[model samples]
Target: MHPRHLTVNRSRSSSTSAGSASSCGFCPQIVQGRAPLGQAVGRWSDRHRPGAVPEEGNPREHQTPSRLRSQRARPRATAGRCEQRRAPGAAEPEPDRRALRRTAARPPAEPPRRRGRRRPAGAAQLAPATHRAGAAQIPCRGARRGHRRVRHRHHGHSSGPRAYFCQNDHVTSSKTSIPRVAIYARQSVEEDQGIRQQLDDGRKHAADHGWTVVHEFSDNDTSGSKERGPKTDWARMLSAFDEDEFDTLIVTETSRLTRSLTDVLDVTPPRRAMRVIVIRQGIDTLVADFQLKLLVLVAENEVKLKAQRAARYAADRRKVGHPTSGKTPHGYRWVPAGQRDERGTRYVVDEAEAEDVRQIFREFLAGATLGQIARDLTSTGRLTRKGARWHSSTVRRVLMNPLYAALLPPAQPTGQHSMAAIDLEACTPGAWQPIVTRDDIVAARSRLVGVKPMHAGTARRWLLAGIALCGVCRKPVKSSRPVNHPTPRKDGSVAPAQRYHGYRCHFSRNGDVIDEFVSELCIQRLSQPDAVDLLTPPDDEFDLPALHTRRDALQAERKNVFALIGSDPSRLAAAQDRLEELEEQLREVDAVIAKAAERHPLADLMGVEDVRAWWESRTLARQRAIVQLLMTVVIKPVGMGHRPRRPQDVLASLEITPLI
Candidate 1:
C-alpha cells in the first residue's frame, strides 16, 4: 500500500481468541527474527500513545477497544529483560509460550528500560530495520505531534519553516531579520572637506548601528544652498527613498545633507518615518524637533555673514587704490607694494600684454571696427589674462576702463551695501601705467560717435545700392516699388495692379533693363583671360616697407606716452595733443596705402571655375559688395520726352567705370 493511503484504524473488536495478537491496520508486518529491538520499541511507542482529555476524566478509560489492542501489542521491556523468538518454519507454540511466561513473570511495578536519548513527547522515531516484500512503513500520531511541537517553538517567527531535517536528521536555525541602510555624504568644496572623509564616517556609523549598507549617495563639490538642478546623487537617493530601498539614511552631518531650511522642511517632513542619523551633530531627523531648525538657521546665517564681510573688505581696499579682486586687467599684473603703505598690492604694466592693449586702441582709432579688431586678435591665437578668447566686449572693457587713462574711479559697491561717494575726477598718478592717452581715447570715441547709425527698417535687399548712379544727375539709382499697369475687368472697370518689380533712375529709365545690362556686361568682362593682369597693379607702385616701419614707430611712441602720463598728470594735455598729431599721420599713411593696394579685381579674387558658385552663394549684401568693388555703373538719361522701352536701348544708356 502507498504510504499516503495508509490510515490508523481506531476501531477494534470486543473479543478475540486467547493466543492471537492485535495490531493497528496500517502497521507494517514484522518478520519475527529480523526485527531490531530499537525498531520494535519505536513502533510500539507510536501505537499506545495516550490521548489528551479533561483534567476531571481518566484518559485510559475513555479510550476505545482499538486503544486496548494497542496497549496489549506493546512489549514490556524492563531493565535487564529480554524476549525469545521462534525459529523459521519450525513449531512455534512451545517457544511463544516460553516468551509469554517470561514476560508475565516480570513485576507490574518494574520500571521500563532506559535507551539512548529519550524521544520528545509524541515524536516519531525511525530506526533502520529489515522489511518484508511489498511492505511500507506509515507514520502515525508521533509525526503529527512533532510538527505541533515545532510550530509552538516558533509561534511568532514568519520566515519560512523553523525546523528542517538534514541528512543526519538534525534541525538548523536561520536568520530572522537584517536592516537595509543608505549612506549619503556631500562636500561643498573638495579642497575644504573631502567626500572620502564624510563617506568613511557615515559608513562607520552605519556599522555601529548594525545596518546593512545597501547604497552610497554622494554629491562632491556641490552647493547645499541651492535646492534644484543636477544634484545627481541626491535625486537618485530621493527616488530610492520613495521606493523604500532602505529603512535608514546615514550622513556625516546635517549640514552635509542640506544648508537650506526650506529644503530640509520640504524633504524631511515626508521622510520623517524613516530613520535619519547624522553622526557629527548627533542629530536624528526621525526624532528631531526645533534643534534641527536652529542648526539650519545658523548655517545659513554663517554663509550670509561671510559674503557680507568679503564685500565690505573688497570695497575698502578698492577705495585705498589697492587691487581687491584676484583678476587683474589684461594689460597689467598684480604686484605687492612696499610694506609701508596700507594698500597691499598695486598693478604694474605687463609689457607684452600692454603692447596688445595699445594695438587694440590703435586699430580702433585707425578705422577698424570693434568686431574687426576682435577677429584679428583671435586669428593671431592671442588670449586674455584669464586665458579666454578675445571678444568684442572684452576689448570694449579695456578701452572704457579709467585705470588705462591713469585715473582712479570711486569704488562702486554691489548688493545691499552702500559705499561712500568720492570725486569722479580723482586722478591717481603712479598707481599704474596707462596704456593709451586720454586724447587718443577721446578721438576714438569721437569717431565712433560721429558715424551715423543705419535704420534697421531700411535694410538693403537690392544687388546694387551705391554702385549704380544716375548718368544725368550723377547720383545713385535706388530700387523702387513694383511698376503697376491698369487692368480692365470683365465688367469694363480698370484696376491699377502691379506688372513687374524694377529699380528707378534719378531721371527716366526702367530699373530691370539697366540692372540686366550691367550684370551681363560685368560677367563678360570677367570671363576674359587678360582680365587677371588688367586688374592687378605692379608691386613697385609704393614703398610698403618704409610705410610699415613708420607705422611701427608711431605705435611705439603712442605706448610710451601712455606709460609716462601716469607719472606726470601735467603731461596729459601735451600727450593728448601729440596723440591727435600721431593719429593724423597714421591716417595719411593709410590713405596712401589704400590707393596703392587697390589692384586685385573681383574676378581675379574669385576663381574662374568657382565664379558662378561663388556668385550664387553670396547674399544680397555680399552681391552689393561685389558690384561696388568691381566698377561704378551709371544710367544716362534718354533725354526729355523720350523713354527707353527695350533692353538694347537701356544697355546703350548705361555707363560703366572700371577701376582696373
Candidate 2:
C-alpha cells in the first residue's frame, strides 16, 4: 500500500488569489478542455453573486470590516493538474472553481517511534495518560532539580534495553516535616519477644528517609506462622492507607511485616498511590523492581518453613508422650531438662509453698473444717502462691488432690475407706512427689465425715437468708438460727438473743419472735428434684402416646415446610428446627424409659410399702422426678396448725397422685 499524507492551510484567499496545486505532493491533476463562461452565464451563477467567493464557488463583492476572512486550502487530485508541467505556469488560471469542491479527503500516516529511554524489563508498566500527565507537570525535559540521576547497570546484552531510574528527590519534596514510616516486627516464639528490634529498625529507617513516625501498630506475641505476625495490624494499616496514613511506609524489611506473598500483595493495594520504602530489601515499590517480588517470596517461604518446623516439633512431642509447652498441672512442676545432670532432677516446685500444702492435709485429718483450715492459714500468716490468703475452695482443692496419695508405697492401709480410694482413681493424677501416703490421705478424708457438727452460732449464715421464700408463707425466711434461739433458757430470760434470727412473716408476726425455718433441708429437697427431673424422662404413656397423635400432623407440616423452602426458606428453616427438636425429645423419652427399667428399684415393689421403699432407697434426683410426675405440692397461706382434714379437699396441703 502507498504511504498516505496530507497538508491543510486555513488562510489562502484575498492576500494571494494565485492557486498552485502542482507543487503539493499529495495532489495530482489531469487537464480537460474548459472555458470561462460569458458575463450573462457568470451573472446567473451563485459564484459571481454578492457575498460569494471562487474558493467555495462564491465571490464576495464587498469586504465586511467586522468579519475576519479565513480560507482553507484543500489539496485535490484532479485531471488537469496531472498534465502540462511548464505550460501550466501562471497558477493554472486559479483552477476552475467547480473543480475543487469535488476534492477527496486524504488518509493519515502511521505513528512514529516512542521518545526517551526504554523502561526496564519486569518493571511495572506506566499508563500513557499518566506519562503525559507527569511530562506536563515536569519543569524541564531532561531532569528536575535536587533529583539524583541513577545510571542503572545493564545486564545481559546491551542490545536488549536501556535501564533507567525514576528521578528521586528524596532530599526534598516534603510539604510537611512529618515523618513517613512503616513499623514492622515479629516473634518467632509465641511469647512476646524480638519486638523491640523491629521497632528500632523501623524508626531508624524512617529517620533515614527524612520522615517522622506518625502512627504505629504492632501485634506482639502473634506469629505469621498461622496468619498474623507480631507487627502487622493489617486492618488498621489498610484504613490509614486509604486515609493517607503516611507519605510512604518505612519498614526495616519486608519480612518483618510479612513472610507471605499474599500478605506482601496486601500491603501494595492499601496504598497503591502512596510509596513503600523497604529498607532491608532496599526496595521502593513506587519505582518497582524484580528483587522486591523475589524478596517477598523468600520471606514468605522462610515463614512457612519456620511454621512447619514448629508444627513438626509439636507433633514429635505428642508422639513421644510429652506435654505440649504450656501450663503445668496444679500439683506438678515444670522440670527443665537442663536442671537434670547426672544427679537427680530438680523440679520447679516452690518448696515453702509445698510445705503449707502438707500442713493443710494434716490439719484436715486432725478434724479441722476446710473453711476452718482456710481461716487458720490466713490468721497464721500463711500466704498462697499468689501471695493471697487461703480460701475454703483453695483448701478443699489441696485436700482432694490425689498426688499426695500417689506418693504412698503400695500397701493395704488401716481404717482407710475403699470409697475414698474409688473417688481418688476417678481424678487423673499428675506425676509429682507426694508429701503423704495414700493411707494418711485416706485417714485425712475420713475425718471429713466425723468432724464435729457445726453449732447453730458456729457456722456462717446462708447467703440466701431472708431472701429465699418459704413455700408455706410465700415469704422469705432464714433456714437456721444460733444455738441460743434453738430452745428457751431455764432462767426465765428471753430464750434467744435479739440477734438470733428466724424466718417470720412480715405480715403475721408483727416482726417479732420470727421462727427460724428449715432451709438446708429445703435446698437439698428442691435441688435434687430439679436436677433429677432434668435427667429423667416423662412417662412413656404420657410422652409417647401424645407423640403418636402428633406424628402424622408433624409429617404433614414437614411436607408443607419443604414446599415453602423454595419461596420462603427462613420460615421453613425455623419450622424444620422445631421438628428436629421435637424428634430429639421423643428419642430422649425412649432413652429415659430404658434407663428407668434398668436403674429404678421400685419396679419390684408393691402397694404402700412399695411406695415407702421407693421413697427410702431412691436418690434425691429420683425422688424429685417422682414428685414432679405424680404429685403437686401446693402451699396456701392459712393460720398455723390448720391442716387439711379431708382427702378430697386437700386444702393448704400437698396433693399426691399416681401419674400413670
Candidate 3:
C-alpha cells in the first residue's frame, strides 16, 4: 500500500485500533494497504518478546504487523510513503501475551533530522513546514507551527544575505525611476563595418531589458578584436562609471567588450564596488561563476589570436616592400592602382596645379621673399583649396616641404598604416609628380625669415616736451598752442597765417588759457649753455703715468729721511718733522693727479660762444629740440610783473639729463 494511504488509515478508528489485539490482527489488506491501527500496536508487542519470532526465519515473518499498519495509516501528504510486504508463511501464532508486553516498550519521540539537498547553487531552498521532526515529510506552502524558512546551501555551504535593505524601499526612494545603463559598441575592422547594426541591436536589447540608457559610447572604424590601444575610450568610460552615472554597462557582444583576458579582468575592479552586468557575456555582478568567467576569457583570447594573425600577415607584406594604403598628404592626390583599361578612364595628376607649385619654388629661390611669391600668385589669380589668396606663411611652408621638391617613388613599403602615416617620410613618386627641385627648396629655406620690413626706424621726440610740466599738477608739459598766428589786416580783412605750437604750464591753460606764450628762444637760453657746460669735463694737465713716477720718488725720499733719523739721533726730531711736511705735499699732488685722470677722458665741447650762436639761428622747433636734447626745463611760473630782470638771474640752473 502507498505510504500516504497507510498513513491515512492510521488516523481512522484511532480509539478502536489502539486497544483491541484481535481488531489489530494483521491481514493482507491491513498489512499492505491501510492497516488497522490497533493491529499495528499489537505487532510491536510480539516483536520485542524475549522468545517471540526467531531471527532464523525470513525476517519478513517477524514483521511487526502493527508497525506496517501504522506506516500505511500515516499521512503521506507530510510523511513519506510506506512500503508493504507479504505476511511470512507458516508464521508462528502471535507471540504469547508476555511478548506483547515486551514489544509495547518504545520511546515516545526523537530529535529531528536534517532535510533537503545540501547545496543551493545548483538547487533552491524548499519552504519550511514541508516536514515534521523525525516522523513526517510534508509538501505545503504556508508556515506551520515552529517552522521557519531557511537559507539554502551553495557549494556545500549555506548562503547568507549580502545586504539587508528592502528592495521596494531602495527603488521607490531613488532619485530617478530610470536605472542607469551604458552601451558600448565597436566594430572589428576599419572598412565597411557592422558597427551600425550592432548599435541598433543593442538599443533593441536595452528596450527589452527595460534599461534606461544614459550614454551610448561607440568606437567606429576600430577593430573590436584589437586589444585596447592608445585611442581606446574605455578608461574614460570607467572613470565616468566610477562616478555612479550608470548602474550597468551593456556591450553589443563579448568581443566588443574586450579582445584580451587582461582587459576582461579590468572589469572586476569596478564591479567590486557596484553592480556590473555584461548582458552579452551573461555576467551579473552579484554572482560569481568561474565557468562563465572562463568562457568570456576564452572568447576574448580567440579575438586576440585573430588580431595576431592579421598583424603577422601585414608585417610580411611590409618586409616585401608593399605600399600600405592610407591617407595621402595635401600636395598629392589619391589615385587607384590600375592603368587605363578598355573603358579608357586613366588616373592622372592635375598637371597645371603641379606646374604652379614648381613656379612658386623657383621664384622663392631667386631671392623673392615669401610675400613677393604670394603677391605674384594673387596677381595671377591663383587660389588655394579654400579658394582664398595665398598667404606668405603658407607659401613659405610649401617652399620648405620636401614632398613638393620631388615626389616619393612608387612601390615603397610602409608600416601598418595609421594616422602616423600622415607625418611619416614614406611617400611614392610616379603616382604623383614633383613640382620643385631639391636645390630650390634648400635655397628657399636658407633665405626665409618670414616677410618683414627692410628699414628699421628710430623714435623721434617733440623737443622740450619731456622736461616741461604742468604748473598746478606737476605732470610733464606738452606742446600746447599754435604760435605763428594770422596777421591783423589793415583793410579790415583778416588773412590766414601759419601758426606754430609750443609747450606751456597747466596754470597757463585750464586755470587760464593764454594765447600769447613765452618764446622758445627764452627756453633755449635757460637750458642750452648750462647743459653744454655740465656735460663737459674739466681740463687735464698731469699725465697719470708721470704722476705715479713722482709718487714713487716721494716715497723713496721719505725712507731716506727715516734712515737719517736712525743715523743721527740729535737731528732725528727735525728730520722727522721735515719728512711729515714732504709727505703732505706728496698727498696734495696725488689728489690733483687722480682728479685730472678721471676728468681727462671726457672731451669738452662746452664753448660758450658756439652754443649761443647755434641757439640764435634755430627756429622755435629747432630751439626746443636743442633745449630738450641739452637740459630739462622746469618752467618756474613767474607773475607777469615779477619776471626776472638780470639776464643771469632769469636763467634757472638746469639739472643734468638722465641716462636713457
Q: Flag regions of model 2 displaced more than 4 Å.
A: 1-112, 115-179, 188-193, 229-232, 270-274, 307-312, 327-332, 341-660
C-alpha positional error of residue 188 in candidate 3 after TM-score superposition, expressed in Å: 6.7
lDDT of 2 by residue, 21-113 (tens): 433221232122232223322433444466665444323333231121111223323223233332435344344334334334334434345
Name the regions of candidate 1 deviating beyond 4 angstroms: 1-251, 254-258, 270-277, 307-312, 329-331, 334-342, 369-371, 385-388, 391-660
User: What are the lDDT figures for the candidates, one per model?
Assistant: 0.57, 0.46, 0.49
Residue 194 alpha-carbon offset, candidate 3, angstroms = 5.5
Question: Positional deviation of 161 in candidate 2, in angstroms?
Answer: 16
**Best TM-score among the predictions, by candidate number:** 3
Better of 2 and 3 by lDDT: 3
Kindly report which residue pairs in candidate 1 clash with one another. Answer: 471-635
Instruction: Please say which candidate is ahead in lDDT: 1 or 2.
Output: 1
- In the range 1-660, model 1's lDDT, one tens digit per residue, is 111111121122224222334333222233233344346445545554576333332223344544544444444322111111213354432235555565568676544354455566856543223223443222121232233221111222223322323223333221333557888888777553578787888788878767679999988877887664544798888778767687567877778888888756654543333456778788765445467678888998887898789879866666656555445778887775453334344777789899778767765544444655666676667777767887766666665565666666664644322211322234344355678775454444343333442321223545565457777677777777655567688999988676554556655455666666666666666667876775455677788678768876877887788898988888999889898998788767655654443323252344456555555543344355456666788777777656676767776777778865
Predicted candidate 3 versus true structure: per-residue lDDT over 540-659, tens digit per residue: 645656776877788788778878777678987778778888878776655655344331111223444554455454333334434444445455565543434444444442223432
- Which one wins on lDDT? 1
Clashes of each: 1, 23, 26
Task: Quote the lDDT for 574 in model 3.
Answer: 77
